[model samples]
Target: MTSRALLRFSSCESLNFPSTMQHAAVISCVFISSLLHTGQFALIETKETVWAAVGDQASLSCRLTEDKDVLQITWQKVLPNGEKNLATYTKKFGSRVSAGLEEKMDFQYESLQSCSMVIRKVMEEDEGCYRCLFNTYPNGALIGWTCLKLYVLPTELHGPFITISRSNSPPGSVVTCSATGRPVPMVTLTVLHQNLSFSHYNTSRVSNTNGTVTSTTTALLSALSSTQVECSVLVQTAAFRELLVTVPGLTDSSDGLDEDFESDDKDERWLVTVAMGLLVVFLCGAFGVLSMLWFKKKHQNR
Candidate 1:
């Protein structure tokens, strides 16, 4: 039927514009309504949201219902600013997919029935929303939107630097283990050899400038035995980093002895510097005295 007749029979209204413009709007609206009623003109059916991991592949697909005349299919990545066209498939022109970006996507089209796109090695930059558009004649465009949420898996979990040193806070030694990892890795200090374990440790967390996290866990050991200590760090159960440290007990006298040696070394350096200065002054004075005596003797002889 003609668009003007369809508008009238469907009771669709528009502004007092040109008959052509009004008819077009009413036709598009009425066509959408009829599609909803019969579920035919709505050709694109896809997932509302999709999730993937970094360095992994994601499958995005859509199938056409009874509507079989799909002229074009375009895939776009939506950002905060605007949408970026990733790839396009046309029945007449085949596919003119991009090489650099298109290498990441494996897009396949089955004429007017179905199409699928795979995102290879999905990255953090690929985490966003996507839009799939199907071009259909007479009815315009049918679209489906899906959000892609990516989990950036953690890597390189390193360093729970375990150190055993003397402390006077509780009149014993202090053991501090600090580590840094991405996605807030779990860090713990344990005595591996003796099966001594403690879960409570002082944690200092810092949000890094590069959108990562740094966690330093300090565990104070007071009067603990000399054993093999281990610093364990990981991102969930995915990655792990462990270091073994042989901890030795400390006495208060050892700390005092270290301080005393440092102080004595400084004092010796200072005394040497002062002694050299005094020797220079003494030599200058002796030279002056000899010059005066020689001058006086010369005057007396003259």
Candidate 2:
């Protein structure tokens, strides 16, 4: 072959080699790009709903599908008015200037591709929708949204009550016990006297129409001495909630010792009455014997 023709054929072969390889490479690139775009779109479309209680920690998470193109990911809070931004990622947006954002609010960025917003000491106002935005090259963008709900619960139960009063009898005692709590409570009262068994009393009442039931008890003790008396109030609420309160007993000084003194005086009076009656009988018998002896002597002299 001629040298010029050989050179031209070699050039043609070189051009064809590249042309054939270009189509395959372009097809492969298109397939990969399609897969990556689809995955990114899925990540943006599917978001999880997060819930947390007040005064607890919460996290908002977002991941990128195309790691190489991920430039920055941001998290922002959208206000209820829809026209203002409540808070924004401060690391990427300069220092945070939001009126409500405080130093305790934590914002964490991962490898410049993922974002996790950690909120400490969450409050009711913190409950709202949060947006996740991803910045990428080649006009690619991904956005995810999540909703957070915060709930506040009550901390503790209410109270148990006790009251005491005297009965109609002079120096007698009466006691009343009660307790109040959420969902109502069962109450029991126990009265204790020294050298005596415990006396128990119980009663219940439903004060509210919301099925809240309250219980009460009343008790009385007689002949009470200057002794320590104990009045106990036991309360039980729904779900085994329990509370106990004890009241010191009332001491009756006059009634307790006076009864014993009166009994002793009556026994002494009875003994004195019997002794006088026996003396009268003996005197009468002596007078009768003397009269009979005088009559017998008069008859003998006649």
Candidate 3:
């Protein structure tokens, strides 16, 4: 073979080699450029917030400003001593970290772009700071933190039991009723006679160191007979309080017994009057018989 022909063949082989490697080199360069762009976009895009209510569901959101495909998103709770991973979202494994979260914390993941964590039923322990972390390919990682506070309110008030006692003497009697409640209670007492209004009293008492209050009221009755009395107690607090009303019929010591004794005395007096009348009638009949006999004997002697 000629030297020029041999050189030409070598040049053709070199040109073919360059042509074969061009497509692969272009693909590599494009892929690297895409990776760099994705990294930069991810670095600028990660931001999130966490919101929760006591005794309700809570959510942590990881929102991306960039429209690029996300690699992985993670949610974590910041405890006093350490951090606890709640949920994770990934593109390849689709949510590989969710199993760990479900097993440990029972948290559920929503989506890839969203590291949104759905906490089952929120509680006092669930309240704290949380972090949303995003791990992107070329861009390293991004972290967003949010602090949450939870408050729970009270439900209802319990009770106040009232008791009444009578102590003292006279035509009028003194009666007292006492009650207790959580917060300070307002007490009102009303006395009635045969459906007629007699007297009304109102008073309030507060608890000192202990969380209890007692109220008392006194009233004088007009007569020593059966009377209907109504007592009402009202308690007020921050959330709510309770109101209790009671009506009680009271009996006097002298009413029924005195009436019965008087009736018995009247019955004895009537019996004595009947006996005197019978004695008078019997004496009159005897005197009449004696006079008739004496007059008849005198006529016969004459």
lDDT of 3 by residue, 76-168 (tens): 789878877767667666654545446335334555555555665677777778877778666556666766555433232334344444444
What are the RMSDs of all candidates, in order?
Answer: 17.5, 22.2, 24.8
Rank by lDDT (best first): 1, 2, 3
Residue 124 lDDT, candidate 3, scale 0-100: 73
C-alpha lDDT of all candidate models, in order: 0.73, 0.59, 0.57
lDDT of 1: 0.73
Which parts of model 3 are misplaced by more than 4 Å? 1-51, 96-111, 157-302
Comparing 1 and 2 by TM-score, which wins?
1
Clashing pairs in 1: none
For model 2, how does the per-residue alpha-carbon lDDT over 17-47 read when each residue is reduced to its tens digit? 4776866655555555566555655765325
Q: Rank by TM-score, descending? A: 1, 2, 3
Please tell me which predicted candidate would have the highest TM-score against the true structure: 1
lDDT of 1 by residue, 1-302 (tens): 54545655356574565889878877777776665634532456778778776789998887776665678888888888988888888867887666687688877877656777789998888888888878878666677777787765785455767776666666454567777667787777776654554333677888777666777777755434566677888765457888888665454446567889999999999999999999999999999999999999999999
